[model samples]
Target: MPISRFPFFSSKRRSSEAFSLLRRFGPSKRIQSCNYGKSSRNGNGKPESNPLVNVDIQAPRSWGTYVIPGALLGFVGLAAIFHYNDERRAIPKGQGNKSSGNFVKGPIIGGPFTLIDTENQTITERNLRGKWVLLYFGYTSSPDVGPEQVQVMAKAIDKLEAKHTIKVLPVFVTIDPQRDTPSQLRAYLKEFDPRITGLTGPVSAVRQMAQEHRIYFKKVEEEGDDYLVESSHNMYLLNPNMEIVRCFGVEYNEDELADAVLKELKRTQN
Candidate 1:
């Protein structure tokens, strides 16, 4: 009966009363209403239809919910960019650095070592002289990353040989000497590129060669005699004098590798 307890107002009430009623509700329910109708004789003096009264509205989303996650994602992106840049900073070549842990501006790579080719021919680092070599160290039995890197090496050299005057020799030296014999190396490499000269030798020789190249590899047994070799996925670009020019990692795709190698060749030629 009282105006304070009974919130509804009677006819001829001031809008100030309605303002007081709206102030009682929290911010979320503060949708404005508009009443437009012909002047009527209704007992309550309210419009017959308040079209804007039931309008659907919502509160603005909190900045914390979206901003925190967005900031975290931005930070992660920056960290990744910095880490990638670090990998590239060790050696300067073309527009981007060669991707790998082993690098130029450091100790010597591409030392003299003896290895037998797929045909059992003695192929030493001396044999690689007077040749531009794109060399990778991996095992034939590698299931995933090894095949991809070898394929990249095969395709990149083929691309360079197509138009470019630079003749690059693609070489694969196996880490799994116990399994990757001359015959196995021949079969595995031929599938990707027949020109890829595969090399395999005794375990001690292979280990010594890997150390010379700063390549890390270890055999983890799976079941019985089956195992996997965890090794550095590095590819070395050697100049004609058998010196390491640049180091490529698993990061490079075929096209990128070809383009990078071409630029290095031109730089050296000039």
Candidate 2:
């Protein structure tokens, strides 16, 4: 009975060894933990080498994608701020600003000036104190925009004078005193309107006046005796008190100029 039991135990031990060998050599690892190094199995039963092809790296994405547009928006905001400041700086100091051809009340601008009129008489702001003045600073040699502006100004004055209530003195001051003598100024102004008072004086006096009124003028392209003078060419509307009320640029036509002056006149009347 003991020998028979030994045979049975030997057979059982061989069966256990056989099972262990099958675990070591057979496809038992397929049921165990996965091998992440080689993720997939090919048709030949070999593991695929490219882990990236099987792994979902696109999931759990980073939050850094919005940085560029946000940075660009910030840069654009800063640029706009700089541009606005530049525009503000470009406007004259005391004159707040104008909008779409509308005038705003600003600091009083002007100073006393001594200049000779076309009539060869010494003229000052005192002489024109009782009447409203439409004053302009320009040069006869202004090639492009000057004559047009003068024409518009003359037409505006004509229309204003035609109206019964308000009478305005139209004065043209030469930025180029060297070339615009009394005779030359008289003749030039008569072509526009005989009522247009043309003024010319010593360069120093003109310079001082221009500086006080914040006028900018420069001489360019000089040839022996003839040169071109460029100026702001601003037309100023002055009250009877000789204080500047508004400044007009070259943008206005005769009708527009007449309308603006009438508007100002009506405002003062009220």
Candidate 3:
């Protein structure tokens, strides 16, 4: 324990030297340089490198961004408009005439034809003048659908006569004249309303009449002696002059048929 003469050997001097060495070897210089660069880069409040840190980057937009969305919107708008038009066209003209404007005009649907009545007398379209005619094409041998439709037609005609003093002759023309002769027609018609008139003739004449009205019918042979008439279920409302006014499908009921007939009657009168 000798007392040191050099100041470097003193306790205070030794502590100051240790502090300088630590500062030289520590992260002070690196921290100072980083702060200086950051402040310089941010002097204009703008970034030198990428502004977003640890964030994904994307390229600039092209024309497809706008075009694609616009095209999709246009397609959707067109589809919606077409669907609206279809719905409008589905409505019948008897309900309203608003959508009737889009209906395409076609050829006249009825013409003159000579047929044999149930009384075995030859009848022509000319004989039914000045009378509204409800014409239906079906066979007497029709099992279910034809009979049901004929019943509906008879009921409608009766209702129309009772309500408006309007008389409509309901005519049943057979598509199967081979099986439904004049006597058979008379017997079959008696089962329904008496106002219904049954008519049957040669197969060629029946087929020509069906063609004029755009009706379809064919005979399908089943088991021995069992035959079926495959035909469309169509009913026609003809004016006094033998021109078709309106056509009905299988879905029409008695009330609907009568209402349609009345509307047409009023329209023709005006």
Candidate 4:
């Protein structure tokens, strides 16, 4: 009789020399023994050994079957974490990320609309798909905000032309289209820069464009002049795809505007 740590299972070490001589190796490891000392053969022609009796090599079956697979899964999880971190770090700061591309390359913060240009052609959001457009939305009568920003945009385009082969079209979108008609816009633009093209269309279209660029404008009641209308003055830099890239405050400096244009040019070149 051999002792077993398992309560339900026991091992019978056959000490009979005749049985031991019939055994293949070591002591006879009786898988199960009948009280009458008989042996049974299974359908495979092998002895029906006891469940508790065998070489008992402790083959690390549990570790091989469960722990190794679990370890592999853990390794894959860790690798995924590392891969995500590496990709996140590779993105340039303030640029469009993998999620989507904005006009200026960050989170989108603008509106949408449709309008026409100087050519009397209908220009929708789709038309802006191929060229970088510097959209200037302001009133002609805006004493300081209107001309100053247009000039800054003109200079920025000039700098971009001098430094790179980028062709940026300056689009002057007038908020006071009621006062600044096509001829009025054309003349007003000449006073600042000849290259600046004035775009005037239907009032509805102008309003739509303003809404798209996140512009605020309203007609102010002036007691003396019926031709006067006040509007929110702002500049929108749009990408080749007619999307608002970035917006400039009424007080943005020329150098800052130039830098922004140049940065966009770099992104475009890339």
TM-score of each: 0.62, 0.62, 0.61, 0.55
User: lDDT of each model, Cα atoms only?
Assistant: 0.79, 0.75, 0.76, 0.63
Off by over 4 Å in 2: 1-107, 163-165
Q: Looking at candidate 3, what is the lDDT of residue 180?
A: 94
User: What lDDT is obtained when candidate 2 is compared to the true structure?
Assistant: 0.75
Clashing pairs in 1: none
In the range 1-270, model 3's lDDT, one tens digit per residue, is 355445424644655565455555544222221211233256684545533222222444789999999999999999999998765534232222222211212225656799999999999998887889998999988999899989999999989989888899999999999999999988888898977888889988998998877788878999999999988867877777777777776777898788878887887799
Q: Which pairs of residues collide in candidate 3? A: none
Model with the higher TM-score, candidate 3 or 4: 3
Q: Number of backbone collisions per candidate, in order?
A: 0, 0, 0, 1
lDDT tens digits, residue span 1-270, model 4: 344333323222443443444344434343332321224546674555552223322233455788889999999999999999755533232233222233445424344555555556665656556878877777678777577878888887887778766678888888876777776777788887788877777798788766654566778766777645555566666776566666566555666676777776676679
Q: Per-residue lDDT for 1-270 in model 2, tens only?
A: 998678666755765566455555555223232332212457665656653322222233356667887898999999999999655534253222233342435434577889999878999889998888888888787888788889999999888878745578889999999989999999898898988899999999988888777788888877786688777778888888887777788777887788888888888889
Cα RMSD of all models vs. native, in order, equals 14.8, 14.2, 16.1, 12.5
lDDT, ranked from best to worst: 1, 3, 2, 4
Better lDDT candidate (3, 4): 3
Off by over 4 Å in 1: 1-107
